[model samples]
Target: MLDWLYDIVGRILVWIHTGLTFIGFDTDSGWAWGLSIVLLTVLMRLLMVPLFVKQMNTQRKMQDIQPKIMKLRERYKHDKERLQRESMKLYQESGTNPIMGCLPLLLQMPVFFSLFSVLRSVAEGNARYGFDEELVESARAALIFEAPIAAQFNSSPEELLELGASDPIMAKVIIAIACVLMGTTTFLTMRQSIKRSISQMPDNPMMQTQKIMMYMAPLFGLFGLMMPVGVLVYWVTSNVWTMGQQHFLYRNQPVAGAAQTKNEGNGSAKGMLSRKKVAETTPEPKEQPKIERKQPKKQSRAKRTGGGSR
Candidate 1:
């Protein structure tokens, strides 16, 4: 089942390598392989844009319905099964599947593993999948500097020391930089996502899980040390793409919390403007005069008595 998938990925990589070679990138040079991997990452991300949009829509729906979900949770605190059922019903009514958010990432796994296998096979001088012996040899000889693109840090210390002696300092530096970039981008991406959701529903149970994931996701960067430099390049490029894509999505199609926050800010601004307008337009009240009518009333009574005596 996976053999076909491997063949497809291998063919794509081979095609990229061939294109690069035709464009004057030396087949045996590290730049060719690195650029091919980066191109592959770009192509893969482009293909997944639709799925990413769907994921964003799903997330937005989830955020929009968070208040209802929370109410259900509180109402059914003692009934776990009922809570689950109501949540499912709410999701159904809203035409949302929260799990859909994972589709793109899950889809990438096969390609990721397949590429890893292809690079590993080429490194070991075993041409498998759709990669021919000549292509594998070219890949094996490709170096980012003095280090082969397929080199991994999983080797023993003595072997690593030997690699250091054989390769230039720039090669090791490139790998370390890629590793750090992968980790940092992952952390930032996850953190931004978590922070956006938390801003909407701070006390949400799902937030606890997301908070845990935010820290855990970056730890995958450590595994970059064990992966081939080619794979690391691909992973890092993908991470950067994800970060940018997410930023664009959040800015354009903001989640409920972000939208609400923006609306509140606008409301406050409008309120202030209204108060200023009223102050400018409205007239102030004037004080009334204090009349003295008691002396006239006393004179009227004295005149009435003199007229009665006459």
Candidate 2:
């Protein structure tokens, strides 16, 4: 079942690639693969624009609530129950969910992995094996270059290894250059996004995580370069597209709650005092004790004895 599904998906992807190729996208050069990758990234990003908007809104709400949330923590200090209750109440009232911002990323992950698989197959010159009849014809027609990177990598593993070992210096140099571009583009894409996110954050744990990924993603990309240079070309172009899309979104919609803070001319003391007074005046009904006390009978005896003595 999985194989059948993959075949169907691969065929569909091939069709799309073929259609793209027919529409002047096929330049018959190594650049054709790169251009296809850019188109794929752009299409995926366009599809995700709605989700991105939602994510931005959620992020902004979270940012706006952060100060209040911090104040709530300080106010509830030792009261765990109160803290949980109030925090939930705040979320409910604000209609802000931190989880929403991550949903777009979750949704995009599978698509990303799928595209990687398809591109890898195509770049391996396995179009005939991976694509359907019509799509295969289209792919062949779309060949902008008679000698693509895929053709170079299409040799048997043993033959490929031999070539790599004894091939002319230029071939190795070309592959190395492709790998470098791939890694560099991936690193730059990741770095730009991380930098944007970091600039928005105020030295927090989230910022630390972003910083870690900024370094890690590039390292991962370097590993990715070990694959055929065709894959490298696809990856570099895709990363370039991603960088552009992110730049546009960041510039236009921008990330949530990342609006620059405007300084208030007046001191915030009045607002602080008002909130404090409101909390202070808010009455919390006292709880009565469970136990009851009885008066001693000795008091009555003492009263009678005193009367008799008098």
Candidate 3:
């Protein structure tokens, strides 16, 4: 079903490999091919810059409206039907849908999976999807340091021997380092998101999720043992890309509640006071009054201004 995506990924990989070879790099050099994988990540992310920016912007929008959501809940506490209607109206006016929050991630999955499939073909020497026998064999022989790009931390002894890793211990070490970098980069990425959330809403439950990811990043490293070194390289490089790209993009974009907490400074005030001030200060829009009164309009001018009009 995703063959179209696979073809695109495969073409890009083959293109990068041929470009390096044209620039005097050896066709079978693991350095060249491994570099191809890394460059593939960079190029792919570069292409998705818009989606990345939108994802961040969307999340920040979601954060920006948290106060409004709270207000809706409070105003309609006794009316479940009204609460749902007002919430939907608020989301519409804000140009936000809860489902849109997941749209960017949904769009990105096929691209990642397609890349994964292309790399799998390289490992198995399948030679389809823009790769010929020669290119596939060259990719199969490609080595990044001691471990073959196709090899993993848990690769069997026989597989290691076939991939040109004479010492099994060295292969594991190299993959371990990549895995460590993976975990570190993952933690850093989550930390960046957490810092943004903390700045916006220190007591947000979302912060709990961020903290959880920060703690689980190390376990992601352990899971890396099951991935091909090439895939590990892809994951690590992609994480690094996310860190850098988010830092760059978010630096220019305004944080959701920056003004409210501008002088708060590093959460030194401890949050409660500022949050209260925000809740108090954020006035509801004039168009959406809290309640409607029919009798007032029905009354004549004699009642409205306490005087009769001719």
**TM-score for each candidate, following the candidate numbering:** 0.81, 0.61, 0.77
Cα lDDT tens digits, model 3, 122-219, are 77779888999988888878778888887878888788778777777888899999999888888888888678768767657667876887889778
The number of clashing residue pairs in each candidate reads: 1, 3, 1
Q: Is candidate 1 or 2 superior in lDDT?
A: 1
Model 1: lDDT to the true structure:
0.81
Clash pairs, candidate 3, are 30-143
lDDT of 1 at 262: 86
Off by over 4 Å in 2: 1-9, 20-34, 72-89, 119-130, 133-172, 228-230, 253-310
- Badly placed stretches (over 4 Å) of model 3 are 76-84, 254-310
Q: Which ten residues in a row have the lowest lDDT in candidate 3?
A: 256-265
Candidate 2 weakest lDDT stretch, 10 residues: 139-148
Instruction: Tell me how far candidate 3 lies from the true structure as C-alpha RMSD in angstroms.
Output: 19.5
Q: Indicate the residue-level lDDT of 30 in model 1.
A: 77
| lDDT tens digits, residue span 1-310, model 2 | 2445446445545555566667776534334544555565566667877887787677667767888888888899899899989998999999987778788768656655555555446544455335644443333333212223432333454434442223434444555566667767877887887776565556445787777776767565456535554455546766776688778877886555444332232336667888999999999889988886887656676676777464
Model 3, C-alpha of 283: deviation from truth (Å) = 47
